[model samples]
Target: MLGQTAQLRYDFPFLVRTDSLSFRNVSLADAILFTLTVTLAWFISSSVCQYFRLRHFDGPLLAKISNLWLFSSVNSGRSYLDFWQVTQKYGTIARVGLNDLVTDDPAFVKHMCNVKTEYRRSSWYDGMRFNPTSNNCLSTRDEIAHSALRSKMAAGYVGRDVDNIEPKIDSNIRDFMRLLGSYADKKTPVDLGRKVQYFTLDVISDLAYGAPFGFVETDTDVYEYIQTTEKNLPMVMVVTVFPWLLTLLNSPVLKGLLPSTKDRLGFGRIMSIAKDVAAERFKLDVNDARDMLASFIRHGLTPTEAESEILLQIAAGSDTTASAIRSTMLQMCSNHDILHKLRREIASADIAGDIISDNEARKLPYLQAVIKEGLRIFPPIAGLMSKEVPPHGDTWNGVFIPGGTRVGYSIWAITRREDIWGADALEFRPERWLNNSPEKVKEMESTLDLIFSYGRWLCLGRTIALIELNKILVEVCS
Candidate 1:
């Protein structure tokens, strides 16, 4: 018994010493070193795994790590240029994010965006969603839902129906020209970009809500419209990479805490404007409402649905059209010969003094070419329009991309391709689109439509936008 007890005590002491060494004797420095070692190991293994996963494709190292590369590129306002550089280095299919590939190849653009393909808009669009739970037309990702909503809202934006809204556009354009005249009379330089934006905002507001925001007459952005849009747009680009962050940001508590000026400019405020317009129109029993909201309601949209649709129109339509207008104006100012030729065309028209009708402007070849050139040179939404590859996986430009990869066409790159448009592709030249041969012009038209985003998700406001652009160009040149 004594021998057994002695043996037990000896073993117990060894066990205690081992336990103390293993659990209780770890110093802070040691713990830190151990943690760092594990972390380094994990990082190396992860990088190696990622490298093998992306072995078929090529891109910068940072792009393979996380979405930060894309987020930073876009948030820094250099995505267009950055895309140019990356695509130049990596060729057609370059990894812009861990799962995102951007291609400049025109064939890839057609195949990926084709309606027959299984590509749908990626989660990046979710960043633009008003309510994380609910979706407006612009932010809806579901194909069937987008189709149904589009069909419901399609009649409201038909090209032929745009003539009915010509009066509203003319009124705003007259006010805008008068304001510009005042600026010219004073011999003071005006921020033409801001002025152009105000004009578009007023015009679109009139169409969407039945009344203008009064920016032209007041010569101010009364609702701080430009400031709000500027602040909020960056967030949309950021969340496109780190989409999980969207949920946290959109959470009520985080939103309340951060509380940016942009947050206040969300769908809630847009919806409020929509509600007020509807109330006023119904209260006054206004005769034969010609505005977009009325058209939406007439075409079977519920009150909430109508409000959502108009909100999309006002938010999406205003700034983009304004950008195109400003870009065209800037290009014209820089190119004196183009401006002179266009103005001469306008002056030769029989109704020179009167506001030119869209139909009449369409007949003016130079004007049409200028508009096409402007659209190609500065597509308003000049960033990646991401689409997710289908579950079956697909091959693009000879590279086999696995299923669920996010892919997009870089319109910025494609439009600037020197090979397609010649050495002067970077230069703003309208004649490229004015090819004399009908077949050649038809081909060019198809190319521009691709940049404007063709297929099932074609821009709905295209017809109205073209009409506005035609009239505004005539008025400005005159």
Candidate 2:
């Protein structure tokens, strides 16, 4: 039996070889020693593989223990810099540490999701636990769990219930424009990114949790807490990428060693709120549908289930939209030619003086192009999407992405690769997306990064997001 398992294991890189070989002829005590010996061999070989360079690549310094630290090091703002630099030197793929592999290849995205839930969503997101009852869209690590919540929320996402979102978005944009106009009137150069963050927080919270978390409408230090929270997301995601280090970091005495205790407390506040809402909303029934809170109640999520779902929704929905808006505004301001062209396109539209209707906004082409360009340049959640390597491929592009090894898609790298996007790939040029030359357009999309990702795991809120964004961009810019 042991020999058979070993033979099957050899078909994949994730298997660790044990030197004790077998206990078939051994006494119970001797077999124990052999098991210990095998464990030690496995550890030694893995450590060596983690630290030393092989024929194909030299691992990054962080990679050496990046997995050990579980990427919770709080230094990923700079780590991102190291990652780009290393991937550059090592070519497109590099060994990220003991157990992680990050690849920037475009085709890799499709390849990674090949298996059904091949890789779990990671455990550290359990940090999202605001309360025991809290269960919403984002925190559930199981694909099966996510599907159940998504099905309940499908009315607000795929079906007519989301149609109500259209009016809600219109009102939010009106409020957003009013806020921005006041800033512009004072000649305030507000951080467009931060303001967009506040705007989306207000919008998505209104949609998801039944009202604003008061990120924008309310004046409190909680707003500051919200800002700090987003700035810490890349770091938070790092913890997800590498989890074992989190256990090490959480050691009682070592807790004080990290700089993100504020994040810990803020998450507590978020969970407490989720619990409060879930407790209150659980009493309501199906006909009570006023918003998403009631929708979940009707859909039959227990109060605790609803709370968790809320956590997931807020995490997934808010920041990405805000980032897209920030990137769009910056991209527009930076490119005068495209900017002027877009401005002209806006003015040329007959709806200029009229309240920009969503339907009318749909008529504008340049704005749509600009939005796509923004996603390409600065995708808000431009983090990696991970998967478990299959046994057949020990590694992609030469490095062994062992079967149990978690692999990631470097979103920024794929979007900017010369082979994928053309020589001016990194440039924020919207016109490149225009379908002028059939050959050129085909070349561009063959690199086909939707930025929202693709196929089964693709984002469901995409259509709603586009509608909300287009309405606001046109109304405000017009």
Q: Candidate 1's error at 224, in angstroms?
A: 1.1
- For each of the candidates, the C-alpha root-mean-square deviation to the true structure, in angstroms, is 5.3, 9.1
- Residue 22 deviation, candidate 2, in Å? 31
Off by over 4 Å in 1: 1-51, 130-133, 159-163, 257-268, 278-288
Colliding pairs, model 1: none
Worst 10-residue stretch by lDDT in candidate 1? 14-23
Name the lDDT of candidate 1.
0.77
Top of the candidates by TM-score:
1
- Which digits, one per residue and each the tens of the lDDT, describe model 2 over residues 1-478? 7877687556632333455443234467766887999998988787776555332555566566436433543244554445555567766766666666566776666655543535455454454433323344554556787777777776756545543676677677767777777778999776656667767777777787667766555423353557556566665666566555456666778765443323345655565666677787665554746576676667767776876666666666777787777778777777778778887898888774345666777778788777777777876654555555554545455455445555666676667777666788879988887855778666555544446666546666777677767876766555
